[model samples]
Target: MSVTGGRVPDHHPAHHRARGRRGGLSPVPYVATTTRILRQLAGDHRSVAMIVVVPSAIIALMFFMFQDAPRRPGVPSPFDDACLIMLGVFPLVVMFLITSITMQRERASGTLERILTTPLRRLDLLAAYGTAFSIAAAAQATLACVVSFWLLGLDTAGSPALVFVIAIINAVLGVGLGLLCSAFARTEFQAVQFMPLVIVPQLLLCGIIVPRDVLPGWLQWISDVLPASYALEALREVGAHPEMTATAVRDVAVVVGFAVLAMGLAAATLRRRTP
Candidate 1:
C-alpha cells in the first residue's frame, strides 16, 4: 500500500497510474502506459542489456566470423544469409518473450483487472502495449542493421534503410504474436513454453535455414502461410538485389496485415471481469 497524506491505498501497477485520461480509447492513458513500460525497461539494466545490446553484439560477431572467410565459387554463403535474417529474427524473439511474459505477470497480479475498472478499453491497452514494444522493436532493428551493415561489413544489394524498415515491421509482427500468445498462458513459464512452439517453426521453415524452393513442396506450402517467410523473403531481396520489387512489396504488406490481426486477437483475450 502507498502511504498518502492521510489514507492508505492499495498499490497499483505503474501502467495503471500512467498518463491516461478517464475516457474511451483516450491517448492520454495509451501514452502514459507506453511511457510506463519504457520506464520499467530502462530501470532493468539486465533486460536493457539483453534486449538492446545483446542483439547488436551478436550481429557484430557474425560479421567478424565471415568478413574474410573463404567460400566456394558457386556455393551459397550461409553465414551472410544468416546475418541478414538475424536482423529480422532477433527482434521477434525478444519482443515475443517480453510481451507474452509481461502480460501474464499483469494478469497474475490483478493489474489487468484493476485497469479494466477504469475508463481504459481493451483496445487501448493492447495498442499501448503494441505501440510501446514496436518502438522498442524499431530501435532494436535499427541497431542490428547498423552493426550488420556498418561494423560487420554485411554486403547487401538493397538499401540499408529498406532492409531496416522490413526488419522493424517483422519485429512489430512479433509483438502482436506475443500478445496473442500471452492470453493463453497462465504463468510466465507457460508463456516461455510457447516460444519453441510459436517461434521455432518459423525459424526452421521461414526460408532462413533452407530456401523454401528447395524444401519439399508441402513444406514450401507451409512456409508460404507463415508471416516470417515474407519477412525473411523481403530482407533477402534487399540484401541480394536491393530493389523495391513487387514481390518485396507484397511480402511487406502480408507481414503488416498479420501484425494487425494479431493485435485484434489479443484484444479479444482481455479478462471480462468488470466490463
Candidate 2:
C-alpha cells in the first residue's frame, strides 16, 4: 500500500491514475462562466454605450462648467477636488443605469430562468456582472481623471495614487449598489425609475454643489449616511492635504461598508430564486 515517501499507492481502485487529469479540467468552469458573461455583455450595444459614453459626457461637462470657478484663499482648488468627486459619482450613475437594464432585460426575456439552470452559482452571477461593470467603470473614471487633470491643470500635489484608490472604491460601491437595485427591480422601467431616487439625493448631499458643514443639522445627518459623502470626503482629504489622518481611515471604512452591504443584499436576493 505504501509507495515512496510513505504515500499511498496509486494502484488503489479509488485512486485512478486518470484523476491527475481532472485537476487541469477544474478551471474549465471558471473560464467558461467568465466567457459566457463577457459574451452576453458584448452582444448588448446599448449597455456598452451607457457604460462608456454617458459617464464620460457627464464628467466632461462638469469639468468645463466648473473649470474656471474661483477658489477661496487657503482652500483647495475646486478644479482639483471637485472634478475627482464628480469622477467618483459618475461611476455610480453608470452602474445604476446598467444594472437596472441588465436585470430587467433578463427577466423580460425569461433568460434568468435559463441561466439559473446552469452550473453558475448566484454569487458567481453577481460577481460576473460586477466584474464587467468594474472594468467599464474603471475605464471611464480613469479617462475622466486624466482629461480633467490636463484640461483644468489641476494638481493633487503628486498624490495620484490616493486619487486612483478613491476613484476605484467609488466605482466598486456604485456597481454593488447597482446589483442590489437590479435584484429588487421588477422591470427595466422600474429600475430606470430608481436612478433619480438613488442618484439625485447623493448629488445634493455629497457636498458637490454645497459644503457639507454648512448644511442644516438634519441634512448633514442625512449626508453622513450617504456612501458618496464618505467617498467625497476621503478623496478631498487625501488629494488636497499634505498628510493622511485617522479621518481617512474612517472615510474608507464607510465606503467599504456601503460596498459590502449592497453586494450582500444582492447576493441574498439572487440566492432565493429557484435554480
What TM-score would each prediction reach against the true structure? 0.86, 0.79
| TM-score, candidate number 1 | 0.86
* Candidate 2 lDDT over residue span 135-209, tens digit each: 777777677767767655657653666776677777778878877777667777887888888878988998988
Tens digits of per-residue lDDT, candidate 1, 1-275, equal 44556644444555455535444578777788889878877787886787789999988777677767788875546566878888888988898998888888888888888887877778888888888888888888778877777776677778999988887888788889999998888788998999999999988999766778999999988898899999888887787775788889999999999999998888887663312
The 10 consecutive residues of candidate 2 with the worst lDDT sum are 20-29
User: RMSD in angstroms, all models?
Assistant: 7.6, 6.4
Q: Model 1 segments beyond 4 Å from truth?
A: 1-24, 72-79, 272-275
Superposed by TM-score, candidate 2 places the C-alpha of residue 69 at a distance from the truth, in angstroms, of 4.3
Cα deviation at 27, candidate 1, in Å, is 1.3
Worst 10 residues of 1 by lDDT: 7-16
Candidate 2: which stretches are off by over 4 Å?
1-31, 66-74, 271-275
Backbone steric clashes in candidate 1, count: 4
Residue 7 displacement (Å), model 2: 29
